[model samples]
Target: MSDTPIEFKDFIRIIGRGQRAGRTLTMLEAEQAMSMIINGQATAEQKGAFLMLLRVREETPEELTGFSQAFRAHTPTSITELSVDLDMGCYAGKRRHLPWFLLAVMLLAKNGKRVFLHGTHEPDSKRLYLKEVLPQIGFEVAQTPDQAKVALDTLGFAYMDLKHINPQLDGIIQLREQFGLRSCANTLARMLNPSNAAHSLQGIFHRKIDVKHRETAALLNDANVLCFRGEGGEVEFNPLRDVTLHLSRSAQQSSEEVKATCETFITKPQELDAKQLISIWNGELDDTYANYGVVGTLSLMLVLVDKLDWNVAYQQAQQMWQGRDKTWPVALPKYNLAAETFDTTGKHYAH
Candidate 1:
């Protein structure tokens, strides 16, 4: 690769060393390194090397913030201009359960909340993907920024795929199949918040990421961010697992959760089935755990908005779940990204 940031060694100097000798990229340094990758300045070898090196060391909050900033620079600035209540990111497809979270977002939409949900399905994943399910259920996904606004004006909600929103980040997210591990793009996608929505919620598979989401959003000065370790990493809850919500607002950070004075609900992960989402919403399935999952997930979002106390929010969530209309008529065809040996950037690997 032609060197821009440093003429000598460039990207490798950050990771091409023994553990003690290696260094993490500073905010600007990381942003510069990412610019090379996204701008097609880095060679394939450098891309792979850079991604794996950071994966081995793990990413820090500043590193995430820097990388995210570089990514945002490449994206259209107008996306953040749109106003929405919550920015919901759904990247990790659920492996062990139906997406109770999708229903919760839709319910909020049903009740006059503007929500923007975005995600991409992994090319090789067997998990129940929201990308496919949303379409399967007859929900139209916005392919462009303008279309997303239309959906919001009309339906009060919209689902967008990263493919259209920012193909650069989408390309990196698909790198998991090549590297067999996540890169900074995974974290980048969660922090996209394209609309710069005043409030945002993210779910992570790792406890550490739960904390990073709050810290980095605080750095970005996001008005409010609520993050927790989610079921299979999608912004849904496992009734059985205790949740610690890391919250960020006004540059101050704190951890919060519904006080749980009531009998806390619990459940084992259910078997995979997208159709189960419809049945559960219609109350035909009669699954105790699934019902509680939806209510608890909604309760968390209600608490995040702060219009009501935790107890009142919990009760409202319960009422919404009970009163949810059964005739939403959503259906899904299993969607697996059409197989591509190369990443979306069209960079071929020596397979």
Candidate 2:
């Protein structure tokens, strides 16, 4: 590695010239550039240019792999024989809706699966974060790596804030609101699995990025990677319809070959909008809604991680939801969407 500090001008020169040359940054170069950018070593102009160029060109899987490696190197890691380690990275939420991921984590954790969710609550027009949501649900959000491991050992789930876990990457999130677009760092952040779990379920809004993620995960030789499009650009779990689920295994299968084995679920959007959908997350819905799309998604995760049969996974999730309280067993207060006021930038404020 070069010992010289990457100056702002040099950073701009490389990316600017690379753009003109129709060249992309190599993983090494991308790592160095991102490190400099995140560390506040780059000037405003350099940061703006780097983000804009990357957004327009998008990131190659190789660059993304390098970016993920760089991110993980700085992020805190925990070692545990967790049966199921899930990375739920959907930070942006529906403008006026609540997130179902939090509820899903609780239900899954209740059943003795170890789940870890990583995210930063800094999205534009930020909604509620796992930092706030987890504590309300009786899980303590850890402030350090050791604290995170301790929490996970005691509780089935733990929330690791990006800022505390990895401040450099957290700084990248701060740039998003100013840049008005997501850079490669945002995409790579989703792939940063500190627990080093072999199974991962990730959701992205842009369908095209799935290919990039697939290629990146393939390059890293990921064990099992499932990328999909979420409901309404939010990473919420929508039961009414089957979201696009892409499965990648570390077998001798090509990307296309692996995708062919995937089964699609298609449902009516209206079905998802029905009160039954809300009840599922709130724990008020019945088993009919269970074993449906959301449950099926959970089942797919189980198959990927523990090699549990699909039917078995489906039944387990359904039975757990059935036996739980109608409302989420946790004491977190319901998010009153109608009553909460948010600024244009997405910060929630009590009116």
Clashing pairs in 2: 125-345, 125-346, 126-346, 283-326
Give all TM-scores, in the order shown: 0.86, 0.74
Report every candidate's CA lDDT: 0.75, 0.60
What is candidate 2's local distance difference test score?
A: 0.60
* Candidate 1 residue-wise lDDT, 1-351, digit = tens: 334446324657766686797777777777777877888888777788888888888887888878888888876765676678989889887665668887887788888889888888776655656776665556788888888898888878888888888898999889879877778787789888887788888888876778888888888777888888887788887677667878888678988654333254544443455566677777778876677778777877887776456678878998998888877644444452222121122222210
Error of 1 at 309 (Å): 4.0
lDDT of 1 at 5: 46
Per-residue CA lDDT of model 2 for 133-189, tens digit only, reads 454444567776677666666666677777776677777777767876666666776
How does residue 330 of candidate 2 score in lDDT? Answer: 39
Candidate 1 Cα outliers beyond 4 Å, as residue runs: 1-9, 257-271, 329-351
